[model samples]
Target: MDAERGEGSPHGGDGRLRRRAFLVGGGLAALGLGGTALAIGPDGFRNAYARVVCGGVPDPPVARPGARRLSEVEGRTVIVSLPPRPRDRTTVVIMFPEGTENARASLDLCSADRYLAASGGRFAVAAIDDWPSADVVGTVLPHLETQGFDTGRIGLLGWAAGGAEALRLAAQLGSGRVAAVAAASPAVTAARAPLRDLVDIPVWLGCGERDDRAPQTETMLKGLRALGATTEGGISSGCQDTAYRVRVLPEQFAFFSRHL
Candidate 1:
């Protein structure tokens, strides 16, 4: 955008911000070789871009309850929650909300308490901050292992942009390497183009049928299924926006539990 019309990039001086500015309103769509196009509008992307310049921002304080604490790993602040009693098989659930502030809240929003209790000692829910790359698994897993987490049966659950990361991580890690992958209102722009690499990993995708994000999620699921990825997807009936409703929490949680 021109200098006069400056709603594009939050930080107007940088070349990087200039490029990101174009995506500020329209968001990003995934398009590439033999891949289906997926659309993710500016809402989640804007939320993510807002965190880019947060150089000195502090991590969100631990407030949500249930054996919660903050850990600085790989220069990223991760919020981890554990159950009262753990199990032999640890189901590490890595969540990627738009920003650190939404990390812990996403868990509670999903009613992690019931599932975590039902999961017994088998599940650990961790939410990450920043624009984490696929190597995030390497960054988070070791810490979990050192903390007495079994490091087996890893699952990825995400909302909006974070859902994109969840799916991307599953692709990077591949089938058996990742036990289950669930996403709520996954934004197509969150994942890079060429989703066929995720053909082996099963994805449980949920979207609000009435939201603008539904078309995007449906397109993404169709493309992945065409590639032979074992996938299950549904539109939640009682939501206004598809980004993590009060309903799909247990539905997705049950999927993860079955796989774990």
Candidate 2:
């Protein structure tokens, strides 16, 4: 497990703009305001703020040759991105988007499809429009198998509250069913009831050192280690924003590739 750090602090003209937007967007999120309003404010903040902070107000992913969307999985829509040359039976990475994002937007934010394509079809990426629970995994796994994914080897990725859901799902399902998990700024609670189930699971946890969730991420890392779980993680320099995602995602993808 390598320690990765994001370089530099927000400064200068562009950096100041980014820093300002980050503060505004984070404040809005804290107030439970809709991202739609933040991204499309009546003022020109959309062009100036979201462009730097909220990942430019993610658009619905464009329909293309290799892109696939499925609506038959228990009435939940799933967005799938296969590698350029997918294998017959490849591992799948399921993404649990943060509250403000949809499946396609989540995938876009993480650049997951491009990473899979760069992997040369080593694995597939799937994002569910709805947050998943342990019960949902039973449905998702079988459905993915039907779609040519090797359901036995599955990776879970998520951010913010979604990351907490991924952890809860991994705990409920256990390591036998879930191959690995990668979480960024997960809003994990202090409850230790689920720690035992994660002992056998491979986890990679990351968060921005200045982010509100940093303390919890540290606690989780310590808790996992105390349980002897194969855990690897680090705190970087950004928050729950786009820069943090850029810094952590490549390593997260590599972590999944190794375990899944």
Candidate 3:
């Protein structure tokens, strides 16, 4: 749903262009039911607002075949989906679930399993359900290495709150360990200290035009670009929920493929 920013984009001559493109394309649909109509009752209002502004409540994602749950990895739940025929030094994309969603929800929301299966096994996908720490990667990487994945090349994908976590991880792990990062509707309001660690890493960020977090994401994107960090993506159609995040997944994966 997000506009691809390259040499030329509709909103502006440069990538600094903001939400006009997405709003022009999807404004009406994004304003579904209108704000007044959604303010009727608490539950009704919340659901309506979510649908119109936070992306519709998506159905639970069905698990694709070849997906495996590995609870033994550092005693934490990790869902891994490998390519049907993986290379001995296979690259891996590690996904961080948003908020309280589990690893499975992360995989389903982003459709990482399907992406891997349909994309000809270019890389493996793993999702973990931990927060605020980079230590998980230390254990997860070694485990993946034993399982035949190349731990050296790694990509990180994070949603909403997880986006900040991904940035933090990439910073803590450094570019030597983390190849790239893709953050969707990230909760980051400004370029924080962690960003200082990512100047060498390619970071792709996207958010919905209607999402409350869009402005923050835009600010972050601009700040990153100002800092000369390798960045892409801006505001997109839809909101801050699963639908919008899912819409941005393809570009994220593509970015990872090019970097990781």
lDDT of model 2, residue 134 = 28
> Over the stretch 1-260, how does candidate 1's per-residue lDDT look in tens digits?
44755555554555455456454533323212111111333344554433332211233223343577677777766677776655654557777765444555656555565556554434677776563553566667887777667666588887777777778778778776788888887766424534786777778887876656787777878887778877876765533332234456656766776776
- Against the true structure, what is each candidate's TM-score? 0.63, 0.71, 0.73
Candidate 2, run of 10 with poorest lDDT? 1-10
* Model 1: residue 233 alpha-carbon error in angstroms: 2.8
The better-scoring model by TM-score among 1 and 3 is 3
Best by TM-score: 3
The candidate 1 region of ten consecutive residues with least summed lDDT is 29-38
Q: Which parts of model 2 are misplaced by more than 4 Å?
A: 1-71, 119-121, 132-135
Stretches of candidate 1 above 4 Å error? 1-66, 74-76, 118-121, 129-135, 189-194, 238-244
Angstrom error of the Cα, residue 58, model 2: value is: 14
Local error of candidate 2 at residue 50 (angstroms): 10
Per-residue lDDT value at 13 in model 3: 49
Stretches off by above 4 angstroms in model 3 are 1-71, 131-134, 191-193
Judged by lDDT against the true structure, how good is candidate 3? 0.72
